[model samples]
Target chain A: MGQRIQSLRAGALDVAPILLGVVPFGLIYGVAATEAGLGSLSAFLMSSIVFAGAAQLVIVDLLAQNAAWPVILVTALVINLRMAMYGASLAPHFAHWSPWWKRVGAYLVTDQAFAVSIIRYEKPMAELPKRWYYFGAAVALWLVWQCSTMTGIALGATIPASWELDFAVPLTFMALLVPSIKDRNSMLAALGAGVAAALTSTMIFKLGIITSALIGVLVGYFAEGSER
Target chain B: MIASQSTGVWLLLGAVGVGTYLIRYSFIGILGRAEVSERVQRLLRYVPPAALAALVVPGLLFRGDNPGLTIHNYRLLAGLLAATVAWKTRSILATIATGMSALWLLQWLF
Candidate 1:
């Protein structure tokens, strides 16, 4: 019982900084959805249902452009393909959970939550359980997503650009990223990925990030330093 | 009977909701059933760092249409400050508090 509480608390705390970033993005999406001709209720429901930030925003952006429904659907799923990688990466930690909880765990696998939890998971086992920790992360993210989108829907995305709330997301990523680089392979992987992503940002449908991420993984996997 | 556009929007949402859920669940459901080889394990290990870096750099260095390599992009400057703090303190709280304060101050000044 004590371990479960500790795990949950840790998950929620680790996710808090990232949640600061989500607030603005969610607000932008909420404003985008309603402006795209979605009924506010449907837009809110999309937050509750579809749940992925970038994909949800893409769907709304395409709808605003009057793209065909099939094009929108396919594009959003392509954006979500990274989640499959996340699922694969996260499987080892979640392997011991019941099948239903595993599915729930997959549903909770946002970029921030996965990054925050996985780094800790890679460490030697502590007394805290992974499931409760993940659940706490999901719950914190879920509430903020719904509330922020709602605020944006009601308020029309009033968050000012001057505030630069978007920076927080990458800032949170930067914090999580540095610790992951321990040796030559990991260092090269990080460098290769940063350069590739910067170069390929012009790709259509935002495929650059995932593609560059894969390149970085291959670089690390085949790189000639394995002293870890 | 009216073919309202909201109906189409609802269809998009519902379809995407189902599609994304399955996409997320795909490997989680399948991979847990079998033990992966050491080769696959090593590959998975690199995914987090690579993915995080991939997500971070563009947001820091690039703007909407133009690259922000110059000093005018205050976010990049602030991000460098954040990275150093993260590397040094290794605390999430210290990273965010110090980084964001630097960002706000940077944006406020120049």
Candidate 2:
């Protein structure tokens, strides 16, 4: 019992900073969603249901434009395909946990939570109760996301769009991705994806982004393979 | 009527959701015990950067139907500069300030 308590406490401490970091992004999302014509209710619903930043942005952008629903859905899926990878990477760590716990953890998994949890889990430790750490991280991230989003929505109508606040979301992502580029294979993947996105995006009307991302993933995988 | 979206749209969303789930859960549900070949595992490592770059490049470069190359399209240049600064400095505050300033300055100048 003491061990479980300690693990939970440690997990909470670890996730506190990450949640704080996410607050601004969530608020921006709220502002963007509303600016893009998503109502407050819809913005809240989208955040809760989609539970991913990039995907929500794509969906709301489409919704604001009144794009075809098919396009919106496919775009959302393509954007979120990375979550599957996150899930696969995490499955082994939580394999021993019960089905319910696994399902809950899956629901909670996000790039940030997964990134922090995985790094901590990889460290050599004795009987650290992995699930508790994940839960704490997930819960902290989730709460901040909800609260920040609500704040955004509350301020969305009043906040002028002139600040170009929407751009901050992607900028935040760029900041996160810079530190992760450590090797050639990853660099090539990034290069391939960027070129593909640029080239294909103008080639056709739909699936340009999705196709580029899928191709990028395959290219990155193949690039890594060739190196090995 | 709530002016709700059409059923086709809903179904499409559902299908996409299911497909995403299949991709994400595949390793756990199907390949849990099976070992991926070393080669395949190596390939999977590159997915992150490639996928991310694919997402962001299009948004930054092309503005609505045209590939604007002028200095007027300073946001992209600024973003790249910020990205470079981020890579070298690993400072989030500096990156955000640089990128935001670039965009604001560009908009003001244009």
Q: For model 2, how does the per-residue alpha-carbon lDDT over A21-109 read when each residue is reduced to its tens digit?
A: 57766777788777876657767866666677767666655565556667677777766666766776787787777676766677777
After superposition, the stretches of candidate 1 with alpha carbons farther than 4 Å from their true spots are: A1-43, A52-102, A109-156, A179-183, A203-206, A224-228, B1-20, B65-67, B89-100
- Residue pairs with backbone overlap in model 1: none
Which window of 10 residues has the lowest lDDT sum in candidate 1 chain B?
B1-10
* lDDT tens digits, residue span B1-110, model 2: 11145454345445655665565556655566466565555555655566567656765776453345555566587788889878987765567778888888877877
Question: What is candidate 2's TM-score against the reference?
Answer: 0.85
TM-scores for every predicted model: 0.63, 0.85
Q: After superposition, how far is residue A25 of candidate 1 from its true place, in Å?
A: 8.2
Clashes of each: 0, 2
Tens-digit lDDT track for model 1 on B42-109?
77667667767877787787744324787777778888999999899876556666777897998689
